[model samples]
Target: MKYISTRGKAPALNFEDVLLTGLASDGGLYVPETLPTFSAAEIGAMAAMDYPSLAQKIITPFVDGCIPDSDLAAIIADTYAEFRHSAVAPLVQLDHNQWVLELFHGPTLAFKDFALQLLGRLLDYVLERRQQKVVIMGATSGDTGSAAIEGCKRCSNIDIFILHPHQRVSEVQRRQMTTVVGDNIHNLAIEGNFDDCQAMVKASFANRAFLPEDRGLVAVNSINWARIMAQIVYYFYAAVALGAPARKTAFSVPTGNFGDIFAGYLAHNMGLPVERLVIATNRNDVLHRVLTTSSMRRQPLQHTLSPSMDITVSSNFERLLFDLYDRDGAAIADLLARFDEGEIAFSETAMARARSLFSSACVDDEQTCAQIAATWENCEYLLDPHSAIGVRAAMTAGIAADIPVVTLATAHPAKFPDAVKGAGLNEEVGLPLHLRDLFERPERCSVLPNDLAAVQSFMASNIRA
Candidate 1:
């Protein structure tokens, strides 16, 4: 299968190439040239497969030309070997129709681990073969920074730099990224919102001089197609447990970067029988408004208990827009420029289509805390702050009863033990045995200004020196 740039100007590439080159050269995202499909029988056959085997089957078609099945299989195996769970992403029945897919089972205690782990492995193999190196730079609201650092740290050929809002993430989230001590891993706590941090990461990519200096400059954010592909695995794992087309399932995703929900759409595209896709947001509901109506406007951001979802600007929304408008990157670039200037408008048709498949809801700080407490009472299930928003969205939207709705438990509740305790949910729910020491590590990170020029200068000087 070939991958084409959303902008329609860059050369088509196979999957391995897309993984190595995060963004298309035309300043656009890369999408599959053609989506692959499977019959119900083939989809059903997945039940007996292991995580690496299932991943090979799902991902091989996209990168078959670039990465032969032998190499691809090895990469898949190496990536999941580090995960703490026997079944990499496990599904649990929370109630009659509600299920939680636990995804924070890797070295990094967040859903981002499922993707970035594979990404780091893939980069190592590819760059080693090519006898080259890269510097991966990214921005994160919370989990992505820590996941990226954990994945790329100690790699001999690759250096990773991640920028996040200072004092923005939950204490555990901050400590996870800052605590890592690796020669190649660098974390910058910036004095700005996630949007500013994200913009800086994007600017480094857009700059012509930086591209030549670091030809391997890459991204580990959801903007990288590989990240989304890696994330789609759990949806399939959960659906098979719920009976799939044998039983059409739905999902409620607590969205921040918008990559997680977009992966569900990928599953649907790949012939998984899914009914509802509920997108749950905190006060940073820029996407909630867009899915409901044509006005994809961003207001001044709001912070909430769910610090991870405290994002007014969702960067992965650009990939969705590219698909919605039939790969029109010119139009997408126009819309993004408008959005930056605090100006965004969409057609009624686009809004209607988005709403047909997606339902959106926002949970405030009070509601988020309440949902955590209530879920524990109603189902004896403890939810993290991010998962609380998803439960609220699923309940309010009234998930299709005929279909079981899987609400993605994106992170371990133990990661936010403070919030869990505040909601009176500090019981002895078992965390993965390996991550028990997450809180005991000494954090080590650098603080930096929000200025774009300063960041660029730091990157250039450090790389050059």
Candidate 2:
């Protein structure tokens, strides 16, 4: 399948090219030339299959010409084999109608692993065939850094640099990225918020001549259609288990950059019977306000207990608007320019477009803590601060009861054990066996100021010769 740039100025490329190049040549995100669909019978068969088989079926149409079925299946199988869970992604019933789909079973203990692991393998397969090398630059709030590092660290053909806001992420999250000793993986403690780091990544891509000296660079963030495409699998997996299309299913996603829930929209587009996708946000609820009213604005970010979702600007929202506007690149450019200048006025139609199949709810630190306390007390379920935001939003959103509701639990509770304990949780839920002694590992990390040129110079001078 061909992938077109959201800005519509760049020549359309196939899936692997889009995956390797990341941001399009025209300073726009890549999207599928056209969305593919599957029938209920085909989706029904997914329930009886293993993850690799199902993943191959779900993704093949999008990458049909770029990847042969046999090679793609091998990549899928190899990627999930690294996961700690036998089920790949398991679902735990929370109530009669609510289930929490656990997505933190992979190495880094965050939802990004679900896709990053697979993308890593896909990259290996593609790069090996073409005998090419690429650099990956990513900006993370918290989970994305560790997950990306874990995925790309050992690849000899790839160099990865992750930029995170200094002192904004948790101690464990910080160490997870910083402490890794892999030669290919580098971490930068950027002094600004995630948006600044993201801007630098985009700026580097926009300036074609400013490519990394002696290396080509791509992005591993959700802007990579490959990453977002990989994510759509599990939402489908969860919905199929809960009976989608045959029976409607609703999803409550703990959201930050909007990539995670946008995958649900892709599932809905593929004709899965999604009732409504609920976006759960913490105190930094720029998205919640955007969906609830025409009051869409992004301010300087605030750090919170749910640090991963502490982003002020949602980058993947641009991709959604591209789809919603029927790929009108001019309209997207105008809309984004207005938003960047703080002149983003929302008409009734824009507001209506936002609220149609989507709903949003926001919870504060207090509510997140209360939700964690009550979940542990009443149901004995331990929740990290970000997952607490999701559970609380789903509980309070007053969503229609016509469908089974699934909440995407984004991270392992142990990732924020301190926050869990401080929130009055028991801290006794058994961490999976492998993470038992994670606290004891010696961590190595370099601290760098949050400057793009400083980062560029560091990479130039310090890359392993």
Candidate 3:
């Protein structure tokens, strides 16, 4: 399948090319030229398949010509084998129709593992075949850094560099990325918020002259089409588990970069019968503001309990906007240019289309804590700060009682113990057995000022010859 840039200026590319080129040359995200659809019988048939088998079927069409089916299947099996849970993405019923899809069972203990694990393997496969070396630079609020590092650490042909806002992430989140012992895995603690780090990565992608001629730059960020494509599988997995197609399901996703929920949007387009998708956010709520007020503007980024969602500039939103504008790259580019200057009004048609499938809720720390406490007391379930926001959104979504609502549990509670304690929970949330020695592990990282030149120089000096 061919992929096209959201901004419309970049040349169309196949899946492997899109995987390597995270952000398009024209400063746009890549999306499939034509989305693959599954029939009701096909989706229903997935009910009997295991997680890896289901992944192969769902992802095969996107990577058909790029990777052979047998190779893709084996890669998928290897990717998910790292997950601790047998179900991989499992669902738990909270109420009659309310559920939480636990997605933190992977090596890094976050929903990002579902995509990053596969992404790392895909990159390794392509790079190995071409006998080339590339650099992977990504910006993470919290989870993506660790997940990406864990996913790609074993890739000898690639060097992975993850930049996260220093002192903003939780201790566990920081250490998860830092403690991994691999010469090829480097973490950068940028002295700014997530947007600054993300901007640096995007700018680096736009200007490649700083890097060596033979080396290519790749992205492990959600801007990469492969990450989004990998994410789309879980939506189908969760929906089918709840009886999809014949019975429509709704999802309340705790999203920051907009990648996760955008995957749900793709699933809907791919005929998954997603009835409604609630865009759940914490205090940094540009997406909610855009949906509610039609005022697509930036706000100062805030450090919240849900550090993962502490982003004012949702990068993946551009992909959705591209579609809302009917894939007019010029129009998307112009609109975003105005958005960069300040607030830009969305066309009534675009707003209407987005509002049709999406409902949004902006919850704060107070509500996040309350949801955590309430869920623990009522349902005997502990939720991380990000997942708490999702539960809040799902509870207030006002969907019909008969239709099931699944909140995507984005991370394990142990990843954010401070938030757990703040919620008045007395119980200790310990790291998984594998990460029990996380604090004892020596960390290797570079603390850099949020300056692009300095960051680039550091990379140039440190990258393997």
Report the Cα lDDT for residue 427, model 2. Answer: 58
Residue pairs in clash, model 2: 179-444, 191-450
**Tens digits of per-residue lDDT for model 2, 276-351:** 8899998788888888666668776777889899888888888888877778988887788778788475566766
Backbone clashes, each candidate: 1, 2, 0
TM-score of 1: 0.95
lDDT of 3 by residue, 1-465 (tens): 788988898999998888888888888888999989999999999899999998998899999678988899889999999999999999999899999999999999999999999999999999999998999999999999999999999999988889999899999999999999988888999999899999999899999878988889999889888888889988999999999878999999999899999999999999899999999999999999999988778878888999999999989999999899999999999988898898899988999999999999999999999999999999789999999999999999999999999999999999988888989999899898999999999988899998999999988877896
- C-alpha RMSD by candidate, in order: 1.9, 1.7, 0.8
User: What would the per-residue lDDT of candidate 1 be over residues 366-443, giving only the tens digit for each residue?
Assistant: 888888999899878788989888888888888756678888988888777766777766586545776567678887
lDDT of each: 0.82, 0.82, 0.92
Q: Pick the candidate with the highest lDDT.
A: 3
The CA lDDT at 272 in model 2 is 86
As a whole number from 0 to 100, the lDDT of residue 430 in candidate 1 is 49
TM-score: which candidate is best?
A: 3
TM per prediction: 0.95, 0.96, 0.99
How many clashes does the backbone of model 1 have? Answer: 1
